[model samples]
Target: MLDLHHIFAMQKKALFFLLALCALGWGFTSYPTVFAGIAIGACFGTYNFWILVRRMDKFDRSISEGRKVASLGSALRFGSGIAAVAIAITLPEYFHLISAVIGLMVPYVFLFIGVFVSSVRNKGN
Candidate 1:
């Protein structure tokens, strides 16, 4: 029931949230530590991104095109989960304990957003 525009909008919001987090880290954390966190985060993000991409590709191949099994919202949720874990791993060493806690929550936020959007669309249909 979800469309491309809905997916894109969610992605845009997520990216903006990420950028805001980065800015907050830069503003509060020391430069060297923030840089290290960024490096670690990027590495983790890249690794997980590839893994999720492969999984999604497999899902796409297995599912019928007419069926909405692995939609873009699902993809975003997966990506956000990966991102949250990455941030949790990367930021704890450099940022405050609270930031790390917030990082851990990112995946759930994305998951809820995805489910809410999907449910709304499905109900509308």
Candidate 2:
């Protein structure tokens, strides 16, 4: 089984770095709205990521204990993503809708990258 804690840690680090970049973009670039959108989306994405991790842990525990696992809260995550989009839509001047959508995908991107890196390192070892 994969180490959830380690994976989550890796993702958190990546997300923080991304947030820093967004901050810089907001401060130095003309497209402050775009960066702000991304930052907001990323915050929601991080929340979703944390929820997924918690659900996954519960799932693993249920499996080990021979109990049925509940749903993974996909709907909740989906709703949050929608809420991010809605926020951008409602505040058009403050956020770019497209950029907000892109921000919502940040965590998943980091997830894949982290897994790939982990696999490569394991292989090397």
Candidate 3:
């Protein structure tokens, strides 16, 4: 099994990179709205990432205990993501929806990449 610490480290790197990218763009554009959007998006992205990590941890625990795991986490994740996007889209005047959306995907992208790397490393053993 892959270490959760390594996974989190990768995710953290992605978060910082994404935040820096947003900050740079905001700085270059001198747009308060862009900064606000990035802030909101980063919050939601981090929230989603933690939720996923928690769910996976719970699943692992359940498996080790020989119990069936529930699927409520998936629904909650989807609902939260949808809500974030909806709010971003509705508040067009305050946030750049595209930037916010991109920010929101940062954690997932990094997590996926981390998983891929881990899988490849294990396969080589």
Candidate 4:
């Protein structure tokens, strides 16, 4: 019911575009660290997003079967975000902490945008 595959495809496309922008910034701009941080965070963010979607799909299945599911793996996702931050902190010369933090949120931003666009498209049909 959720069209999860389509959602993931859209998100992947958006993240790839973002990575391209990060590449450009890293190459052309003065703040290479900032772009690098964003790129790193986005990569981790994409992984986290995939995990969430996969868990959600399982959750839906569990519900349909009248069974109990463990959780959405918040701990795993939290650890991932922490790991990204840790990487940034460990490499202070190569990555900006604030930018990495912002980058971690990029996937959710794209998710919201994609949902909004899909909703609008559906309404138009």
Candidate 5:
């Protein structure tokens, strides 16, 4: 069984990799569209991260109360990369460059935020 820390680390690494891929893709693609994709992806990624954190907090509370906690489904749902990719594919041609950059950066930003939040919470305890 995976511990919380292990799970967190795994998630963080996945996010980082996703971000790097997005950045690399952006660099290889044209401008504008890539930037737009990145911007949109970042917004979505941040939103997903926050939602996952809240859900995890709730799950922890449930566990403390002896209730059966949900599996990692929520996390998977929140990290739905398919949605991000779909959005990226739909970006306007003129904004493709920006979108690509954002796509790459968003994942890394998500991981950073998650790690920062986790560290802060651990320190508080």
Candidate 6:
């Protein structure tokens, strides 16, 4: 069985790689506004993920102990992205809304990469 912790570690590395990718974005896109938008999204995604993990941990523990705790991570994650997009759209002259929207998907990008690599690697068995 694939180690879950190992997978999460890979995910973390991928998120950091996304951050590094921002430098490439800034250098290649020649639009600091877009890059800034992406950077903001990527940073927020990282924080959102961290918050999600913690919230899940707490919720899981509560469940194991036969209790229920409301999980707000999902709302927070969506809320932050929507808020960022709103900010970007409202300040068209400052940030590229499209890029910001794309940037918010950084986590999913890493998620697909992890799943693809894991499936391909395990297929050799």
Please tell me which predicted candidate would have the highest lDDT against the true structure.
4
TM-score of 6: 0.78
TM-scores of the models, in the order given: 0.42, 0.93, 0.72, 0.93, 0.51, 0.78
In terms of TM-score, which candidate is stronger, 2 or 6? 2
Candidate 3: tens digits of C-alpha lDDT, residues 82-123: 777787789978777776777677677777888888889999
Tell me how far the alpha carbon of residue 64 in candidate 3 is from the true structure, in angstroms, after superposition. 1.2
For 13-123, candidate 2 gives per-residue lDDT tens digits of 888998999999999999999999999999899999999999998999999999998899999999999999999999999999999999999888888888887789889
* Candidate 3 C-alpha error for residue 41, in Å: 2.7
Whole-model alpha-carbon lDDT for candidate 4: 0.92
How badly does each model clash, as a count of residue pairs? 0, 0, 0, 0, 25, 0
lDDT tens digits, residue span 5-121, model 1: 455456446755675767776778666455434434443443343455555666776585666565434566456556655565665666433444444444345546887878998
- lDDT, candidate 6, 1-125, per-residue tens: 44444655776787677768877877787687888788777767666766676777788788899987877589888888888888888888767888888777776676677788878988997
If ranked by TM-score, best first, what sequence of candidates would result? 4, 2, 6, 3, 5, 1
Give the Å error, residue 84, model 2.
0.5
* lDDT of candidate 4 at residue 108, scale 0 to 100: 87
**What is the clash count of model 4?**
0
Ten-residue segment with the worst summed lDDT in candidate 3?
A: 32-41
The deviation in Å at residue 92 for candidate 6 is: 3.0
- Model 1 pairs whose backbones collide: none
Error of 2 at 77 (Å): 0.4
C-alpha RMSD values across all candidates: 7.3, 1.3, 3.0, 1.4, 8.6, 2.5
